[model samples]
Target chain A: MRSPGSRLRATITSYLLILPAGAFLSVVFLYSLARLGYISVHNGNTGLEGPAQIDAYRFIVDDPLFRQAVKHNLLLLLSVPVVTVLALTIAFVLHEGIRGWRLYRTIVFVPYMLAIPVLGTTFVYLLSLNGMLNSLLQTIGLGSLRQDWLGDPSYVLGSIATIIIYHELGFGVVLFLARLLSLPEEVDQAGRIDGCTWWQLRLRITLPQMRSVIMAFVTLELITMLSWVFAYVYSTTHGGPNFASSVLELYIFNDAFSFQAPSFAAAAAILLLAATTVLIAIQVKRTSVEVNPE
Target chain B: MHGVSKGARRGWLLALALLASAALAACGGSSDTPATSGGGTTSGGKVELTFWYWGEDDAPGANGWLASAVKAYETANPNVSITVVPQATDTFTATFATAAAAKSGPDIAAQWATGPVLTQVWNGAITAISDLVPADETKHWLNTSENTYNGKIWAMPEYLIGVPWVGNKTVLAQAGISTLPTTWPELIADCTALRAKGVTPFAFGNDTYWTTQLMLQSLSSVDDVVQASIGKKSYTAPEFADFEKGWAQMASAKCFNDDVSSVPMSKGTEQFAGGKAAMTIGTDGNVRAWAKTLGEANIMLGKWPTYGSGPLKDYYNATQSTSYFVTSWSKHQKESAAFLVFLHSAEQINAWYAATGTPPADDRFDTTKITGAIDKQLYSFNTTGPQVWLQNFFPPQVDGNGNAPAQQLVLGGQGDAAAAATTRETAAAQWRAQKPDEVKNWSNFHPGG
Candidate 1:
């Protein structure tokens, strides 16, 4: 056995080894957070005038365009989580020795790998007035169901939401499939032997085991959906046939670069960051329910 | 328990060490420098200057013209080298902004004459070229005053841009329309005729901001108040009502494609080129692009329709300068300014006009060498009845926020000619409310003030 001094020395050496990484994390993550906070308060000014007196935050809060964007982003945020859960459930089913599952998974996930611009263009073609969707509907004797999916403000967000869900479902499936494969077969077998139904076995054993993975996937999907509003906007309607489909990310872009107000853009970005933080905090809280369990 | 704790500590240390190495690698890696040819001195020991610009992928011929011009300028000076960096149009703004932030921006950069230049000027990113450009020379160029921001000329005029009605003669003939539309009633008549022949009346791509700007300019009447607004003056007259009326007509008529928002400018141009649509409001560059796509003989250009007789009798064509500005961060300002002056000279202007098919703004440049029919129409538009667009004259944020959003209003069934007029009036009023002191003295805010 090592002497107490030698063991203490080893502990010191390990801490020393970790010091550089700790410093790096402080800079990359903590530094960015601090910088964004400073920018949010002081506005995006470079000169020695010591931050413009303008209430940049107030401008963002009051702007109609910004409010609409926030609302749209919230809708997307709400929709993605539900979609992820459904996708994971579907993925679990396919992974359960279902026939033709490989083909099914391939067809579902193929859209996820498509370039955003290409996907946008394809969707635009599909959703156009005389597009494939409309033609198909007409041929099926459902001509009354034909509507301008892209042009109508009422349907535009729904169409975009559908695209988002479809695009992200593949990654969720792949992740859930991997997690499902890693789950201990004995735990599932025990649940089965206890006379539990397939759903009960899944809920009581498999899902519980894959809890951490599901949490991770949920966080990743939420962040991605939050940030990728620009791709969807640029591809389909450019935030509109009107402001019908604007999201906070696109709103920030239009405000800063498009409108030439970096201060305003910075303000919008801060608000978006704040919103994202709140979401992440809520998610963490919900996931950590059993963290301190007795 | 002790062993588990110790093992966890060791694992944590190892993970931290790995992360630290990654962080170091990220920071230490040299950024890939965008291509720059004039970094070192040439054989003649001349000061090399870098010029950044946006151009088409197949524009080596234009770049060749630029190279020859640079060579000519070098021969005259014998102590200067001009390096040209041609960037794709989409990457231009972001690249320039990044370069500017890094303090390694081009000595001279091409500027879009409207809000982009004004926004940069407001931010103090650009240097005033008033000292570089001769006062006499500036006066001779139409709409040169528009480039002035807060009593300083920020950019030099290169070419005057105008919205020309580009049409395929064959398409029009097929639609049985003999004469081009010259008024609102005539446009409606033309649209009706074209619709009857199962052809779309207008080829518009609302995916880009420029398309919307062109449409708005076409709808508004060329009044003094409107001109004043374009010139960034404080005017009390309500002019946008007339514009809104025109907008309503267009929207109600379904003159453009339903999928306009999805169609980019290039796609719209292609559609027009392919004779799928009768006409599109485009600039000289668009005309050139169309001429290349369609045969030169098939494409024709005409002025946007006029409204009333007398001073406003002439149809208004939107004009702007595809200008160049020297950044304040430029280390070689003298050399950069000298190059800009050389570019303004008749020889270089003529060469650029010949190569790019862009009409030269300089008076000394000859237009006779431009053989294309579209070129002739552009020259005529420049010489005859042309007016600067309102977006070109206003501050960046106002135009992007106020005018750009108004495009959606028109396209999305919420606007008309009267509503467009109201929107502009309301926008002007909002501007006045926002900056009362500045609006109170429009002359003081004028670049030439």
Candidate 2:
């Protein structure tokens, strides 16, 4: 056995080894977080002003738009988890000894490789009045079924969500597929010998194994979807046919860069960060519960 | 992992710490010197000045004229050397903000007129250019007043770009329209006739906001009420009924193609050039671009329709300067100002106009050097009754003078004319209320503000 002194020395050396990474993380991420907090609380003429302290939290909390953005974000958050689970299930099915599995995988993963701009442009084109989707509807003698996908306020969020789901599903599917493929064959064999149904095998064994990956994917998707709402809203509706699809990202951008109100934007950003943190915490709890069955 | 022994790891960590220390030292090094002088030395050696601008890949050719002018300037003043760097348009604002925060921005930078540039001025990021270009000299430039912030000129006029109604001459002739419409009703009639000929009436790319600005300008005819609201004059007026009617008509008429949301401004311009459509809203500069694409003979430039009974009978012109400002953080402000003065010289202005096929801001430049018909037409438009676009007079942040959320609303049909008018009014009120102390003459209202 290693001596206590040596063990303590090794522990100190390991921490010393990670010191650079820790410092880097502190400087880049922690420093930014601190700066964000500082800016969020202060409402001076510019962000750097010290004496003028405005309660940024109160400004955002009182606004109806902020509440709506939060609601939309929550809705988006709820949808992503469902979509990720669905993707995982589909990926599990595709990993089975099914015909044309490679083709199905390729079809699912192709959109993930495409740039956001290209996908956004293509989706906008496809949903347009004179686009292929409308043309197809007309050809099928169901012209009445076609509606203004982007123009109608009722359909805008749903259309944006659909695009987001389609865009993110590919990555989720590929990730789940990789995880599914990496499962030990003996686990499947053991489940088969026990006469467990396919669903049971997946629920009891496969999903448990994929928990960490899922947690990681969930975090990544949350961050990406949160940030990407602005680009989609900007590229398509520009936050509206009437602010219908305006989310926190776009609102913050408009407030900060467009309106020259960095303090307001900083407040919005702080809220966003808090929201994201809460979401990550929930995911972590879910992951921990999954890992520790008792 | 195999190669990294414990000693090696320790050594690596030490090296990294040293590098971090060095980086921190470097960052802290400049803080010692006072930021006012920007730590620049005027020794016997070359005095290099950095210039930043948000332009395209095509800018270098246009900037090449300016660069040659700078070289001549350098020859005259042997100690100075100027370097022009063009930044990506989308990233320029963010980059400038970051640079301003870091206090390491270029000596001189191009600023869009209106809200955005005004925001910089408000934040004390820009140096006043009153000393560089005297008020007497600036008065000669038609649009210089638009770039002035709080009675202090912040930037010198580089070029004045104005929105123009551009149409395909062949398409117009084919549609049997003898002359361009001067009023809204006539425009509708013309568009209907063009549609009857199986031609797309308006080649609007609603994917971008500027296209919407084109349509909105046509509706309101850019009167004083609109201008004042945009200029943060008054925010309570609600006299934009005509603007709403225009938007409603546009929506109902399907003036834009069904695939408009998919097409960008460049593609729309291409379609108009290729004879896929009869007319599209464009700027004088765009007319030049269209001419290059479709050959100068095919394109016709006209004014946006007049809808009001204002004294300004001329068509709506979005005349704002592509201005350059000396950064307060600039190390070589004197040298930079000298170069900008050289750029604004008559010979350089005429040369840039000749190369770009767009008229120079300088009145002294001979127009005979400009050969393109569109250029001639725009020059004539400038000479005639020119009402500067109202949005250009607003603080830069309000609309990027005409670039931001306003354009987006135009494309999306979010805010009708009344709503746009109200929004403009509200924005002005907000500005006034927010900065009552700063604004002395908030009551002095012009129609367009």
Candidate 2 yields a Cα-based lDDT of 0.64
Please state the error at residue A54 of candidate 1 in Å.
Answer: 0.9
For each model, chain A TM-score? 0.88, 0.89
Cα lDDT of model 2 by residue, B326-411, tens digit: 88777677677767777777778877776666666777778778665677777887766555655554444334322343433544
Q: How many residue-pair clashes does candidate 1 contain?
A: 13
Docking class of 1: acceptable
Candidate 1 chain A lDDT trough over 10 residues, lowest sum? A40-49
How many residue pairs clash in all the candidates, one count each? 13, 15
Q: What is the DockQ (computed on Cα atoms) for candidate 1?
A: 0.27
- Candidates 1 onward: DockQ, in order: 0.27, 0.18
Cα lDDT of model 1 by residue, A1-294, tens digit: 899999999999999999998898777655544444454455332212346455668856876677888888777877677777878788888988799998888887898899877888888878866578988999999999998787777888888887788788888898888778877788888888889998888777777777766776786666656655578776887787566788877776654444434455556666666565566656655555532222
